[model samples]
Target: MGEDIGLWGVPLAIIGGAIRVSTPFLFVSLGECLTERSGRINLGLEGTLVFGAMSAYAIAYETGSPWLGVLAAMIAGTIFGLLHGWICSLPKVNDIAIGIALMLFGMGLAFFFGKSFIQPVAPDLPAISFGFWSDYPQVQAALKVNILFLIGIAASLGLWWMLRNTKIGLRIRVVGDSTDAARAMGLRPNVVKLLSTAAGGAFAGVGGAYLSLYYPGSWNEGISSGQGLMAVALVIFARWNPIYCFWAALLFGGAGALGPALQSVGVTQGYYLFYAAPYVLTLVVMIFTSSAAKTMTGAPAELSITK
Candidate 1:
């Protein structure tokens, strides 16, 4: 197996893995970006993602439609978001603490309710096969792209455009930048944040949908592996730009693919090292972006860390 692939197979494996893995990261980061840009943070997203995964899988199993599962996940995520937003909007509640609590809550809900879903044969999301150009089975398989991947890319571009040119985008920016300014303009910061958080949670849910209905295509306790939490750091690394989030997601996805990619080419000696690529890259990004001298140059003034 190793000799058949040789050194050339590693890169191709990584590319294929990136396409598969980047979808979740892209959606999660975009969700976090939207919430953060509205001057709020929801660390509960990890739980949200897990719950979303469970919901999507269960619904798909029941309905025989992957798209319906996606919808269910988004709805589940919105409920989680509303809970987080409502609590955090109170006079003295800490968003981080609430987020942690919600994370645990979300996880608990998924675990308890999802027990029946384990091992069920759920409907899987369809992929777009670009593999027809290749005669080799490996090449053809590697080129199979999921429909959600393309949607994620388009969504990122749309987010960037909306944030730069729309009225609602302007409000989100202003509220995120300065609460007092928003209040002066007679806008309710809490209301805006509530909506943004819900929207963010929905996006995270969609990411979770990709996990179960598309990629690994299953429901289990250990499905996430911190992809949701990692996206928070990703938001910072991308400097909160939606377009940059897309590229950053692909990069992270590529890093995550390192170990599997090498293994595809029969190089398994350092498998764990390659698997650690994403975490290492995350730490490096945090270190570089952590300069106090910069005063968080691109950060919103009302952001939790900033305030």
Candidate 2:
């Protein structure tokens, strides 16, 4: 009975970890998909994520509502996106360099504003329960999922549908494929890129909010651990598809949980290696997905990196 219980617990723990950890990746990767689809990249998303976390934490602490914190984070993210879009649209300013600069700026801003908010407890988000049918403790633990995970799934499906079936989606793809063609077709490529980048920033910001308000529930200097950057890599591995982003996020989440799960099971040696698992997996995925021949065909033509 004990062995059966232990064996069953592993899968359940992995599921719970997926729900707990994947929410941010889902938001950021989906957002990055939108930006990349419009032939632009926003490396500043790291900054956006951190700033969003800080802004969400502050607002939620002040307003006494976690939802309001999320709203504020979105607004802040939108503003950051707009700023990034406006700046990147300029002549001779490399988008990648601009992204890096904006990341530094955003991080600075977050640190400055978050200085006074070190210890306040923000309102917590409510978790959804689906454990009613599970009599086993392991089953109940696994079935307890975050509401954001469901939201992320719905958002991915909605984005996938819109990108494949909607007119705006078509326009965005066209712009990403060839700016010259977009201009010839009487579509403003710059406008499309700007809007998409802003939207991406908003998503990244919300991802940040999820980290501070939901998962970790606190703010500090090192709150984000490269999840924003990894989401960018994940987007490529996901082939710029929102639905794939959902699956990729869950996979990364599981990889992240592996270390802690091992620790929980009384296996603590090589903890550092386990901590590196997600990044290692990300690197492996990127190497496989970003082959010279494959990316030339798969990547949007107007995109500067893949080109």
- List the global CA lDDT of all models: 0.89, 0.85
Please give each candidate's TM-score: 0.97, 0.95
**lDDT score for residue 75 of model 1:** 98
Candidate 1 lowest-lDDT run of ten: 1-10
In candidate 1, which residue ranges exceed 4 Å CA deviation? 1-5
Compose the digit string of candidate 1's lDDT tens values, residues 1-307. 2245566667777778899988999999999999999999889999999999999999898989999999999999998888899999999899889989998998899999999998678989999989898766666667889999999999999999988899999999999999999999999999999999999999999999999998888889988888998998899989889999999999999999888877777675878787889989889887877876555767777888777
* Residue-wise C-alpha lDDT for candidate 2, range 1-307, written one tens digit per residue: 1134775565667777777888998998988899999999888999999999999999999999988998898999989988998998899878889989998999999999998888888888777779979777666766777776788889899989998999999999999999999999999998899999999989998899888888877888688888888888888888888888898999999988777666655565886588788899889987887777565444677777776
**Residue 168 alpha-carbon offset, candidate 2, angstroms:** 0.8
Top lDDT: which candidate number?
1
RMSD of 2: 1.9
Residue 15, candidate 1: C-alpha displacement in angstroms:
0.7
